[model samples]
Target: MNQLQSLKKITTVVADTGDIKFIQKYQPKDATTNPTLILQAINLSCYQNLIISAIKYAKLKGGNHQKKIVNASEKISVLIGSEILKYIPGKISTEVDARLSFNKEECIKKANSIIKMYEEEGINRSKILIKLAATWECIAAAKELKKNNINCNLTLLFSFAQARACAEAKVFLISPFVGRIYDWYKSKNPNEIYSVKKDPGVLSVRKIYKYYKENNYKTIIMGASFRRIEQILALAGCDYLTISPVLLKELENSLGVVDQILNNEKKYYKNNQSLSESEFRWHHNQDAMAVEKLSEGIRKFAKDQENLERILSKNF
Candidate 1:
């Protein structure tokens, strides 16, 4: 079997793209989008007409109410999300604005707003995972949203502290980044070549997965931000791996002897634990690489969001 076919036998593969064309081609179990992916998809030549149509629909709905077209940046995100949903069989993760990552109440409000937009399109709330960065406040917001039956995908997660807090909140899922974590380490030691077996990013995720499985935490570990096919295959049996189209295509074409690298058979007895708010802050602060990368991830997404808004405003 090809790597992609082999992967499906062990893991739930998710397409990490907003481009409908590629999404249809991969037909992953689920689909996810951030502001950055939405921005890139909307600008693609094949998706331009779709973007224009969504803008037109957004303008037509212009009003003084919550559904106003002036909110096209978010509205367009939903439009893209809805289109992708048509191609996938499972949930779609639509992210909250990265700017709201630190504001629990604002993140709560924005998450509901994004959900409301999806619901307005007649999409059921169950079909969407309101994605928020795995900041302490955002995790808190997700906890609150979960009370209201809103599922959340805690994203931009880099450290065990972030992952632990999200699990404590009983959030539906957490996307612990593998590539971004690897990138930070590589930049500091460019001459060192790392294999999938010893890759820092791969190891970081395995630690979390073992912890979660050992402790029986319910939060789904959806590994994200893969740098290479080896990284993806290294995490072969994560709960879910949201893969970019480039890597997805590579997996689809390559014939390989893929094996299940992760298993839940090992039980760890080290004190099953959770981080309190202060402990969470302290642990996150102590991890220099996580601190740097998490902040950079939020900033980059926020900037990409602004760029999307500018394009929407100028053209629409």
Candidate 2:
């Protein structure tokens, strides 16, 4: 078997794209999308009908111009996510506005709205994973959403504290950004030639995987945003790894031994403590890489979101 086929044997491979063609090609168990991806996908000819549908949806919904555009943006994302679900058996993570990351009430409101939209399309809530930024407020919103049976995927997760808080809040999944973390460390020490085993991003995911398993946190560790196949190979046995089509295509052709680097078996023991908001902030602050990357990721997503809104606005 090719490395992609072999890797799927141990890890749940999730397609990290908004494009239906790639998701259909890879046949990943699950699929995920962000504002950037959705924006990119909507421009393609294949999704033109979805855009037209969203424009009509916004017009019929009948709101002020800004409200109509916001509604249209949400509709486009849900429309794309619903289209994705037609091909994949597992859940599709539709993100709340990244602009709402810091607001607890708005986060919860937007999540419920997204879930409601999916339900209106005859997609059950069980098949949808509400994707949110891993801010303290988003985590808090997720905690409440969980009580109402809305599963969440906390993305842009960069620190141990973020993982701990999300798990304690009983989130369904947390995506640790492996590639971005690797990028940060590489930028700092550009001269150092880092091996796959010693890769900062791989090491970060390993640490999170070990901690979650050792503590028996039901929350899953999905190592996401990988830069190279080695990083994905190193995280072979993670709960899930959302890979882009580029890497997925590379893995499909490459022949190599894919080792299981992480396992559910817990070899070490330590007391796991829940973090208060202050503690979460302080601990996350201590890691400069995590802090910088998390902020940058959010800003990037937010900017893409605005770009998407502009597209929808033009349609109306």
Candidate 3:
């Protein structure tokens, strides 16, 4: 078996793209999307129909120019997610607008709106995982949404504090990014070459995986944003790994023995105590990489969201 087939034996592989063709090709159990990916897919000829549908939906909803554009952007997001859901058996994570990342109330409201739109499309809430930036306010919003049985996947997680808080809040999932973390460290030491095992990104996810399993936290850790197939191979037995299509194809071609590097049986350091919001903030602040990356991530997503809006507006 190729590495992809072997890896699937131990971990749930998820496709991290808005493009349905890749999702269908990889046949990942789940799929995830954000504005950046949606924007990329919108320019493709195949997705033009999805855009048209979103335009019609937005027009029928009836709002002012800005409101209509926002509505259409949201519609296209859900529409893409809805289309992807038909192929994958597990949930699809549709993100809340990153502009609302720090506003607890707006985040919650937007998540609910996404959920409602999915429901209207005949998709059950179970098949959708509302994604929010892993900000303190967004965590609070996720906590409330969880009470209503709206499972959330907190994205842009870069610190243990973020994971700890999400676990305490009983979030359904947390996507701790591997590639982005590696990129940050690599930027600092440009001349230094890091091995796969010593890669900071791989090490971070490993630490989080062991901590979650040791503490028996229900929040599943999905290692995402992979820069190379070696990182994916290193995390062969994680709960989930949302990989892009290019890396997924690489894994499919390479024939290798993928071992289970992570499992629940191993004992590791554990933090049983929950973090208060301030404590969480303080701990997260101490990590310079996390601080910068989290902020940078939010800004990038917000910009892509606006770009998606502009594309939607032009089509109308």
In model 3, state the lDDT of residue 22: 88
Q: Compute the lDDT for candidate 1.
A: 0.88
lDDT of predicted model 3: 0.91
TM-score of 1: 0.93
The lDDT per prediction is 0.88, 0.92, 0.91
Per-prediction tally of clashes? 0, 0, 0
At residue 36, candidate 3 shows an lDDT of: 91
The reply for model 2, stretches above 4 Å from the true place, is: 267-272
Estimate the Cα RMSD of every predicted model relative to the unseen true structure: 2.3, 1.2, 1.3
Instruction: Write candidate 3's Cα lDDT for 209-231 as tens digits.
Output: 88888877889899999999989
User: Arrange candidates by lDDT, highest first: which order?
Assistant: 2, 3, 1
lDDT for each residue of candidate 1 in 111-155, tens digit (9 for 90 to 100): 888888889899998999999988999999999999988999999
| TM-score of model 3 vs. true structure | 0.97
